[model samples]
Target chain A: MEFINDLMQYEFLQKAFFTSIMVGIISGVIGSFIILRGMALMGDAISHAVLPGVAISFMLGINYFYGAVLMGVLAAVAIGVVTQHSRIKNDSSIGIVFTAFFALGIIFISKAQTATDLTQILFGNVLSVRTSDMWITLVIGGIVLLTVVLFYKELLVSSFDETMAQAYGLPTRAIHYLVMVLLTLVTVASLQTVGVVLVVAMLITPASTAYLLTNKLWIMILLSALIGAFSSVVGLYFSFVYNLSSGAVIVLVATFLFVLAFIFAPKQGVLWRSIRARKSKSAA
Target chain B: MTGTVSVKNLHVSYHGKEVVKNISFEFNSHKLIGIIGPNGAGKSTLMKAVLNLIPKDKGKISFAGDSVEQVRKNIAYVPQRSDIDWDFPITVIDTVLIGRYPKLGLFRRPKKSDKAFAYKCLKQVNMEEFADRQIAELSGGQQQRVFLARALAQEAEYFFLDEPFVGIDVASEKTIISILKKLRDSGKTVFVVHHDLTKVVSYFDELILINKQLIGAGPTQEVIKPEVMNKAYNIDFDLLNQMGVGV
Candidate 1:
């Protein structure tokens, strides 16, 4: 209860709270498409691949956002090129490219001797989010969220049916690259809240939970964002009261929601499926 | 431009292997045309190449005597049913509304008229009742009709479908063919990759027969000759030869 009230008393706590919520909203909204397109592994790949970008950015004393975004987009493009040019499938391409980038990141960090801690980069320090970081999250999150809004229809068709989108002269390839770019932006925003390793989970879990609840894409997106934000706020409280890692607790809360949806969602859940199965058995 | 499509000396290869080699045919007349071939005959590949969905190793596809680029807006292609992931969470209304996407212009959602038109297409395909349901929950035939509705919403002059009848219910097949016939009668050129030979004469006004290269193409009655049939199927058309027109 005291933790919940800390928002009114502590300005830093408020910054952490708002930053995590913004992170949740971005994750939920963009993650809907990621899960819908079966790009979970791709999300995982891009997040992991951003490490090298961060390391280089730290080494060069540049804003980490620029480097991470650059690296993430490059990694995505590399994955696309590899899959398209070779016999290697998408999953294998992602695995090969991301791991190499990640290895390079490790090497860069080891040699740089910079103050940028590897553990901090890998696992974020959400509790220490400054006012400036909060503003950065807001700007980045707003841009991506607005982009998603502007291109909702384009993204829908291209993601749902690329061939058909192409038939319409929709520039499917360009749209694909644009999606990768936005994903990179989203990943960079997430890096401060959930760190690199847990970023994909934040992106995928809430969307997946919403997917279990609804068949409509818009509804699923709405549900996902709401669930994501709720989890963030609740997780922030839990972290405050228990002195737990905010990022880890946030992810756990999101996963808990997913588990709840998986078991008990009315539209398509294990419980409902079993109930339907048993009803058929009784009828027979 | 009015509906007409021409494929000239088209060659498609994958991994250094020729899938479709030296195929050329001119299809006009704004009529329903069936592209029939045995499995692995590159029928699907031919459609994909013509639509520029797959890169053709060599050759040109023209529409209305122009390169495909100028007339691309007039064309709509529905790939095979198996090519899609049905489990994607999109409602039927939205799926059909995607047909309007090409016409929707930039940064525009489906407008009121688009919604009405999508609903109208659903009605035409007798799928209006299922518009709100998730597409994956529907049966195979219903799913095919939903795709057809989407294509119809495109309002294109040239329609290309890969196996519209494969693995679908008879009612859906009938509905789809009727819709195609209507489109043709309304002066839209329709091209389909078809497999069933027995119903060829009944379904299409023209037939494009192929193995890898073009075997014969023209009015269905004139092109289903025994030699052409033999060339396409690698079997003596003796059985079809006995039915009169094969010879």
Candidate 2:
């Protein structure tokens, strides 16, 4: 009740709340495709790759979104180039590129003259989210959701069977690059809420939890978005009451939901499988 | 429309190794063509190169004088079962609906007619009962049927299947071979990359033997000779006799 009153009273709280919700929804939506495509490591790479750009933007007295998105896309392209041109596998390429960018980001952050808080960028301080960041999050969120709706079929086919998709002239490579771009934009939008380090949790945990609950792609996506939004709201409330970091709290809430679903999902849960096994065994 | 495919001097390499070397063949309509070879003989590679699914180092492939791009919608490919991720979150009907994507093009949703047609294709493969089931919930034979149903939904003129008989039950193999025969009788072209040499004479009307190159291409009776089988598989006639081939 007090949180609701404060949410009504304070403009910063309103911005943070709305921004977090948008971040949650878009992360869950795009994250569904990422995990389905087996690109969860790519998602983590793009999020971490945003850090050097954020530090550079702070050094240049500019908004971090532009730099962060640019770095994210560059990192994605570099990973693609390395994997395609060399014998190195996708996971190794992602690890090598992301860690280099992360080290560069640390160097840039230490040399920054301004009093930019690295902790906030690492773990997010959503309470101090700028108004412009909120607006940017809304725009990115809208683009991600719209693209998913328009390209759901293509995404589904390409992820499920790339060879068939390519055989049917679907331009599977182009679709892959487009998804990478969307991941970059999603990483940029999520920076103000979950920050760089914990954004993958926001992207992956909710979708994985939803995966346990459903067997259809559309239903999984919808449920994942809902779970993400719910976690964000509840985490924000708890963060406010306890004076905690909003990003960490939100990630914890998402993880908590995942735990619940892991044990109790109706069909795919471990407990459900055990119960079915016992029943069959008794019948035998 | 011309219902023939011609390939001249086709070459396909993987990771700088030539898997399919200087292969060329001509396929006519209304025939169930079998691509038969030993393991690592580039049978799948040749099929993929012909379908333009993978890049060819040097090749001139024409579909009745039409380019692959011009007739892509008319082509349907069923890759090996191992290539698919069965645990993916998709329903059987939805998987079949993917075939209609080529006809629907981009930015358009599947309509009632499309759904009805997908159901019809499912029924054709006797998989309509499993339409709503998740793909992972299916048996190996059921999964292959679902894929065949998806190809049927494509309403394609040319069907390319790679190792369709591998890792499937005898019932599935019979069902799939019957479907291919039916399609061939309807004047559509069907190509199967088959590893099982015993079923070659019964399953296909024509055979294209390859050992990283074109060993022979002719009627099944002519291509299944002892010398040709020896050249393609590099094995003795005694072993071929053991595999139930009366060569």
Give lDDT tens digits, candidate 1, residues B32-135: 99999889899998988888888889998888887776766777889799989887889999899999888777898888999999999999999999999998
With a 3 Å backbone cut-off (N, CA, C), the pairs that clash in candidate 2 are: none
Q: Count the backbone clashes (under 3 Å) in each candidate.
A: 1, 0
Per-residue C-alpha lDDT of model 1 across residues A23-134, encoded as one tens digit per residue: 9998899899998788999999999999999988888988888889999999999999999999999999999999999999999888877876888788887778878779
Over 4 Å off, model 2: B238-247
TM-score of every candidate: 0.97, 0.97
Best by lDDT: 2
Candidate 2: residue A39 Cα off by (Å): 0.7
Candidate 1 off by > 4 Å: B240-247
Candidate 1 accuracy as TM-score: 0.97
RMSD of each: 1.8, 1.4
